[model samples]
Target chain A: MKNYVLNNLPERTEKPRPFGVTMAMDKGLSVREVEDLMSIASGYIDVMKLGWATSYVTPNLEAKLAAYREAGVPTYFGGTLFEAFIIRNQFDDYRRVLDKYKMTYAEVSDGSIELDHDKKCEYIRLLSEQVTVLSEVGSKDAEKIIPPYKWIKLMNDELQAGAWKVIGEAREGGNVGLFRSSGEVREGLVEEILTQVPFEKIIWEAPQKSQQVFFIKLLGANVNLGNIAPHEVIPLETIRLGLRGDTFNHFLNQSK
Target chain B: MKNYVLNNLPERTEKPRPFGVTMAMDKGLSVREVEDLMSIASGYIDVMKLGWATSYVTPNLEAKLAAYREAGVPTYFGGTLFEAFIIRNQFDDYRRVLDKYKMTYAEVSDGSIELDHDKKCEYIRLLSEQVTVLSEVGSKDAEKIIPPYKWIKLMNDELQAGAWKVIGEAREGGNVGLFRSSGEVREGLVEEILTQVPFEKIIWEAPQKSQQVFFIKLLGANVNLGNIAPHEVIPLETIRLGLRGDTFNHFLNQSK
Candidate 1:
């Protein structure tokens, strides 16, 4: 489609570009739905995460993964699924499941289960040897607030343990981890982590539009964002390029 | 596909049944996306509404409509589109657009505009002759709270004026009509309206899960619900059938 209103918009990084990655959440979309989503949004989506333990209940798992693979969008099981395996003493089985599905990426998270920090890093190291690992830092429990320094330390340790990117958990609702119950981002916590961690190596799970806008404004158009809804991919892209009303003025002054 | 757990579930009215209606809101879905949605959710969806004026901006409108038609789901332009025509003195053009798209249903709403009550009923009467009109009876503005008595009167007037079903406007967010800013149902308003207006004749636009649970609890499994997101169709069905956790206990004691 031809550009509708092309003037003073921000430039977006192309696919395979390290920054400006969008990772969409699949909370049980059918195979056809995945195909449709990929047909329209594959360009904007960098990776797809089967949200939580939905892949366990979702029918046609292999077909859904194939659809994403056909679109060249890497797919991975959500971090909670990994935790589910760990809690059940099925870490080796989880690795086999990843191989069976031919998944290129894996998410290691401790949101639902309590695990030693060192143990979490060891799991990350093992998974990284098989496929690219994205370790998630932060708890899904809204009551368990991790200090800013702890977040930075966990992220750095995970990266050192072979995680390609450390994800800041916000859950699918964007109400836990990096955000408050009211969906407000912990600004101080975020800024403190940013002081030690490079923004490009972190995928912030920003499911809400307001959260996405906050990251874009803070980290520019190339900030990596995860947990985007399938339908919101285009809208998120528009927001990143300042074509949407929310950040239209933010990128208006910059030369194209 | 066999249901995972089938016992102790509430009996849902089958497709073509009037009482337990589900109206899904399509903000902007591509043709393929609509096809994918219909494939999995056609049985659950009673009708589909193109939310607000999205039809004006959405690409491939006819193709998208065809996909819904193929699935045997009735499609309609939103009430905001109807009001857009009325304010521009293009009511005739609006009718032509309905015919052009071969729509079987149309929504008549004054949520976005300030149409006089009598004039709104007149439009309802006129459109009812051409298509099955689903007239909405609420304002979009959160500050403009219509009293319970007024809500009852407007609903009755529109139903008498030939509306197939009167819709309680909650917009797409479920936070304006029939609900508070917190997405809480206006219990007093709803109870008072039910005392006069038949619950079967009104489609409650409840986009939130809590609101859906409230209506299902208040009016049983057959209450008409509208403004449900496309992906939520199956989840809503599960809720109505007490297959989901929210309504699981509510229908557990009911006879099969």
Candidate 2:
């Protein structure tokens, strides 16, 4: 099928984008589903995360890895996978297995587990020389909150340690991290975080439509968004390009 | 591959299910994307809605229609399509075109356009005999307010007029209809409507995850949830069966 445009929407840059990057969170999608996603929404997707230890469940990760690699879309195991391996004292074994599978991206996160700052920096420094390492911030549990100032400090430290990008963890649902329970961005926290980090170096995981709208409106259309549900890919693209009513009217209203 | 229990969750009834039905809403999925969805999640889906005039833009709707029918999942246009025809005064032509595409179901709704109670009942009577008709209540736009009394009356009348299920409208967001902006179910409205209608005959359009959890908690695990995003089908099933963290803990807390 030919590339089809939905509306008079701005075209997103092809792969190796600095902004407007879409990272799909794969919460255990079947091989067929992933293939379909790659075929149809590959133009929109920049990276695919095998969300939260899902890669460990599927047998023959090689085939899945190959499919993504062939599509020129890099794939990575979620940070929780790393945490699990680290907890088991099998971080080296995890890296070896990933190398065997020819995986090139690593998501380093301490969302569900603890990693000392020096050890985290060492991991980032080692992985950065070999692959693109996406370091994530914020705790997975709502109760284990990371203050905005601490989050920024950590984000800057990780990036300076050679992390490719710092991800604001929102999990599959948008409420767990920088967002409030109502899916609204905690404006004060967001503003504080942005004050310290380069906006382009951060990927905000805004899964819900409202959050996506909020981020795009506040941070401009080129803001990196992650953890988008598979089906929402096109719709998110439309929003970013001002084809959808929400952002279309929003930008129009702003201009007026 | 044999169907393994999802995350050690219990098995759900397969497709052609009499109860425990999951209907996916397709706002503007391309034919290939639709094919992919059916390929991956067809087992979980029973009905697919070509959400709100999206069928008009999607090319090769017939082939896509045939694909879904072959998958044993009947496809239908959204109620908004029926309203569009009603507004255009081409209801008969709409039915004919639907038949031409071999669509087995039709949605009757007053989401955008206004219809008197008598006219709404008449339309349901006209459609219910010809095809499996799903009638919908509640306005799509926030500015268009629907009274609880009128919604109750129309729901009861539609069922009496032979509609298979009366669906409460929530659009794709699950926020504007029968739900507040927070996606919470309007308890007073729901109570009033339930007084006049059977719960089994009603399919509530709960698109948001929170709203799905709300309905499952309020209406039980057997609640007929509509407008579920294609990707959320399995996750919603887990919520319904008390396998996921939220509902599982809910049940655990209740037992204690």
Candidate 3:
């Protein structure tokens, strides 16, 4: 946390940052593991998402939540849990658990289920009244590639419905939505969506190194990226600061 | 650690296991982070590799070594470091450091350096006197694909030279050695290698889940897997035990 990071590295935005945010994906880490990650890379992590359906089965979930809370890191359950609750008609129960954990953020996504777009926005509106909403737009299934115009429209509608950030769903594999099966970014679709959507209001879930490099190169170092693996948090920070080889020259300009 | 795991899960080979050895690749985790990880998952880890050149730059490397030693996990420096030292004529210095660290295991490798097969075997023969050697036999570069016959011969020679285990090099990306660039297993090569080399004497570095599943299915549950990311140790154990969906049927023999 001190001078361990190099001096020539790009200056990163501090906590409560609007742009340079890195959200870690917690895939059922034990409390001790959470303690471990926070001790090392907590400075780089802005938010933590308990990856899809993991929180339900993980042991010591409350203890894990307590550890994150003590570290002042905002913890939210993943959107797959939202879909799980939606299909089971347990929306109120889901809301009650979020309240029980005193969580500050909630992700509303229909990646695995079909919810009418307006109905999803309604849930987002209601949830936004309490916790901050991070509404994800796009499907997890590689078969369902939503049109570029549809992506733009849903993003706009979600933002208007008081969603804090509209997540472009690439899943943990980085092989759906904005990316192809090969994990390559769709140039036309991404370029189109970025033109219509405010970059600040959208978080790209890029879990792969190449995808992270692509986004950082395309949008500069401060671009918000999510679903980052816990151990990769430090590596991702280095990439953001132009300290890693991938972005070593991107932020070196002193004229700025 | 109790019955948190399901009843139908495959019986895991317990501590001091021979076949189901899971070697964790520690790329310079902090002392505190190492302590936290060992506390939670040390029971699952058999050996740990301080990944390529990390021990050189990492702070508290001694403390990190102490933790793995206390946890019953033998720690070894990576192949690249051995290559680095070998190129600089520092094999004695490297051995002295191993003695200083009280490391019972050393990795003799030519992955990053072009050591003659005879010289490599001699390093294995000499180092085997002091510590148990797990010699790796493959090039790290994607361009240089070692033929299947050569793989079997080298692996046999390394084992004959006194490598406790011969590691099939897949690099941490799961894309080299006995695997294709797409991370898919080179099935015929692995089968051919298995015919000539003893299965128990080989540790395959399977860094991806699909590759892990492939080896698990091909070689059965107790396959020795290495270069596993730290967090994935538990998930890999689950895969071995048929706790996950991927290998649920393979390890489960019950009619019900």
Winning model by TM-score: 2
Per-model TM against the reference: 0.62, 0.64, 0.63
What is the TM-score ranking, best to worst?
2, 3, 1
lDDT value for model 3: 0.84
Which residue segments of model 3 deviate by more than 4 Å?
Answer: A1-24, A28-47, A52-62, A71-168, A182-256, B2-11, B52-60, B80-95, B112-126, B141-144, B172-175, B180-185, B208-222, B231-256
Error of 1 at A246 (Å): 12
Candidate 3: tens digits of C-alpha lDDT, residues A9-88 = 66668888887889889875778878888999877888999876566545566788999988889989888767656665
Local distance difference test, per candidate?
0.85, 0.79, 0.84
Q: Between which residue pairs do clashes occur in model 1?
A: A20-A222
lDDT tens digits, residue span A31-89, model 1: 87787788889999999987765565455667788889999999898886686567657
Query: Candidate 3 on B142-235: residue-level lDDT in tens?
Result: 8898888999899999899999999989998989877889999999999999999988888999999989999998887789999999878766
lDDT of 3 at B190: 92
Q: Which ten residues in a row have the lowest lDDT in candidate 3 chain A?
A: A52-61
Q: What docking grade does candidate 3 earn?
A: incorrect
What's the DockQ for every one of the candidates? Answer: 0.08, 0.08, 0.08
